[model samples]
Target: MEKQNISVGLDIGTTKIVAMIGRKNEYGKVEILGVGKSKSLGVHRGVVNNITQTIQSIQQAVQEAEVTASEKIEDVTVGIAGQHIRSLQHSDYITRANSELVIDEDDIDQLINQVHKLVMLPGEEIIHVLPQEFKVDGQAEIKEPIGMYGGRLEANFHVVVGQVSSIRNIGRCVKSSGLELEGITLEPLASANAVLSQEEKEAGVALIDIGGGTTDLAVFKDGIIRHTAVIPFGGNVITEDIKEGCSIIEKQAELLKIKFGSAWPGENKDNEIVSIPGLRGRDPKEITLKNLSKIIHARVVEIIEQVYVEIKNYGHEEQKKKLIGGIVLTGGGSQLKHLKQLVEYITGMDTRIGYPNEHLAGDSDDDIASPLYATAVGLVMDGLKRQDRKAREAQEELQLEEESYDDTESVEEEQVLESEPKERKSFLDKLTERVKDFLDNAE
Candidate 1:
């Protein structure tokens, strides 16, 4: 059977790896076909550390999703984030060959290619170069410089960088799982796309994705990503702190956090208590809800404060740089009770838990719309977009082939033209393959 218009998203999170299959419906909403989730092993803080186990986990998730969707899965879009990922803002200018020529997509591509050449610390590579704003001959703050005429094309970029070995490991795992990697989207950017609206991005907003092993921050202003940061701390630390503070097992600690965890100590009464069964056959232990809240509150505050510091570093305190949309939190960690209240109190910014329902079909499962699936949904959207791009390119190639056949009396010329568009892989996909080959050659 021919493959339908479906895109799959693979979110290799620290806590869970999810494979989500989806397609756009008639009403321009994303209809989720199926989803498969498995406990993530061999990955920590969003980076792959164990190839064999990671490939097993990925294959397991993909197989489950394929079974549910009743379709074969081949290419998948992956999400990337970790403590090692960092973003920097840089401004660059390009001297155009001709002053009379109008700016176009090629000009922008050339400028982006220039930014890609930036030197990085050893063992690191550029993952993304997002343009923030453009300037034409010092006429600054131009959002779109296309169609304008100028000798110098300049722009500010938000460049994301990561460890090459870590990224290569992820690529290797995906390939070993018998799946082709279509693309990789920054986890923060993916979640932001799923949750934040265009208006929020235009007015300025901060998106905080509190995942299992890391907290990702993406600050947007004037509809462009202005800054991005990844904090090493996340929900896992809170669970660990609870485990140590309460002298309980990791499983019980995670359950307690999910079931009754509160980020506001004042909201929980001291008399309210929950009992945890002892390991094996020991006596059950009783803990006050108030104490649990205190532990959660402490760690949640630490994370919010760190994110606040990053926001301030982005010049949010400045009158002109204020984030009018305040903050929108997502990810599995963001589901903690009273976390939004605590964040608002700490940052003095309006805060809300972001859900991925904005672009979902009306009949989508309620659980699928939760913040936990925000990155997965966004990756699916990105995959669909890439699929559309590929379709368009194919159609254009067909048209060119037909035109070539008409213009050329020789049949050999048409065959040559048809074979020319094979090198249409994504640049990052090529990079991943190149790095994989490099590693194999060293071995």
Candidate 2:
């Protein structure tokens, strides 16, 4: 008996590390096979700052997930984020090989490889190469070019890059915990995959992942990634603001944010106030609920406004007119009360909180379906996609090898014409057909 399907997702975030394993069930929906979570240490501002501590955290999370799933974990699709992550668009041109101008996988791969050679900063690495659109001889916006006849092929792509050192640190941490990295996907893209609908992405939308230390924004239009940015501030900043504003400790601030914070001041009642127990012999102070909401509202609005600035700087405003899907807010911070309203008010776009329930099993627990798990769930899906992709690539490579062998055999037969052999046409044809059938069946 061999393993059919199993996937794991490891999300290293500023506040916590989450590991989730999922597999397909009989009904075709993805079921939650395992879940693990641990308080993250050695991480700050969404990047791993201490490798050993992070490794311990990852090991614990993986162990918990393994026990829950009753399976051993080997590799994972890790999610990466931080302020240094960047995305840009580029295009490359390639001519068809083998004479006929038929665009094939080789041509597409060649164009992508060309873009990977594009220069970047001294310490950055290309994490993923995403094909945006293809064009044939000046015709714009072709999706799939394979099997199409064209004299020249060009492809526009969204290249995702990140700090080489930071990515290496993540890999080191995971590898230290005995797991190989299957792939590294940017956090915003992962969250977008988990939340955004194909129709919404095509219609134009910005996915805002409000994590502990950074707010990640992925702008999509025409169903392609237009831009991605990481704002250096998030829900944690708002909590700090509440603490400073009310003379409370950080832990108290976090508690208030979770218990009573609202994204908009108007959502708070006029007479509502939280009675806070004072320290030492000081008198207990009454903190107005409206004031708390106002503090939260100010920071959250500023974050949303910054997201707007980034979107505008990318010159995506015109696209927004028709990109009516508006903003999809996810992550732990997006759970703020009245956040959707605040985002809508500031960005003037229809807003909704996105959840990771798109592919969730109906019997799955409620905690697993929250927006905070968007990136985690998407990482698992990304792993599945990578496995399928690698399988296809392996088959293609073997097919190319077989074709090369056949070409060599033909050349040898032609050279040895003096010892001419019978054609054995039907027999050879039948063998070739059987080989094809074998490969097809194996797949």
Candidate 3:
């Protein structure tokens, strides 16, 4: 199989590092060949703070995936998220020299490239430039401007930005692990792709990915991403609360949160309690479930409120910004008991747990379908889409080359009949120069 046909997704998250190997199956669904996970020791809130530990974790995950899939891994599409990630809206346009010429993909590409050149704050760089809408000569809200005649083309872009050092740290870890970076995608967007359906995007929806150290939000309307934000708190904070409130170790706190915590405090009975083995040799300490739920409920409410504030900032009061499809929660933290219910109650919108099974083959492992793997699975999907696009572009280039060759033959006959050798050489030289320039600018 071609190298492009196989893709790997590396999710260097706060709680764990996941390496997933996947390829498009015959049915056009992702066939997950193998998945490997390792405890992430160096990453905090999605940023690599310790290069050595992060590289070791990545290697371990990739080695396990290789063993399971029986395929060596090299290139991987990675996911990025943290408090440092931010997004904003900007409008840009370009004037065409020939107004009579219909706008094409090249025009759109040029417009996007212009937006990429916008000056950012010091130490910041644009991660994604998503075109929200387009306008041609003041005609607004054009979903696609291709094949339309226009003198001035404008577009509103949702640009995601991040800290340069944070991104470089991730790159360093990937390089030190002996892996090539295929691509880097925002974690929220990746999770959204893995869990959201076309209908949901069309109807408007909000995706909340509650990972170990950060909660990511991605809002979509009219099939376009409108907003993205990263909250600094997540499941790890709740675990910290548990540790402080219950006076327990980090491992025990995490275990308690996962096994017995609930977002709704009222659901837990006062009489229900669990005992934790005391450290060293002391008597076991009993903790009431209701109290534990109360602690979790407090933290969960804060996170939900922060996320809802972002949702409101998207102009939710306006009819166009209303999310009829409501909120879909994913990631490891979304598994907290009654989280969906809590989100619905607080935000007053429909809510559901999002599993990353939408694009997976039916025969895929159950573990791969969990919300925790959403970002990794979506990264693989992005890789496959990119590969398909490259293949299509290559095919079109080949066809264009054949057509140009045929045209050249006819032109050569005309030149021979006219005996214009100088004109032919000049034309051929110009064409060769143009081809070189085009190839140089292709990427």
Give the number of the best model, judged by lDDT.
Answer: 1
Q: Which 10 consecutive residues of model 2 have the lowest summed lDDT? A: 419-428
The list of candidate 2 runs beyond 4 A from truth reads 1-4, 94-100, 280-282, 319-321, 390-443
User: Which digits, one per residue and each the tens of the lDDT, describe model 3 over residues 296-389?
Assistant: 9999999999999999988887986799999999999999999999998999999999999989999988988999999999999987876776
Candidate 2 lDDT, tens digit per residue, 136-242?
A: 87888788777788888988777777786786677778777988676667789889988889999988888999999899999888887878889889878998999
The better-scoring model by lDDT among 1 and 3 is: 1
lDDT of 1: 0.89
Candidate achieving higher TM-score, 1 or 2: 1
Decreasing TM-score order of the candidates: 1, 3, 2
Off by over 4 Å in 3: 1-3, 403-405, 409-443
Q: Which ten-residue region of model 1 has the weakest summed lDDT?
A: 418-427
lDDT of each prediction vs. the true structure? 0.89, 0.81, 0.87
Model 1: residues with Cα > 4 Å off, grouped in runs: 1-4, 405-443
lDDT of 1 by residue, 265-296 (tens): 99988799999999888999999999999999
Ranking by lDDT: 1, 3, 2
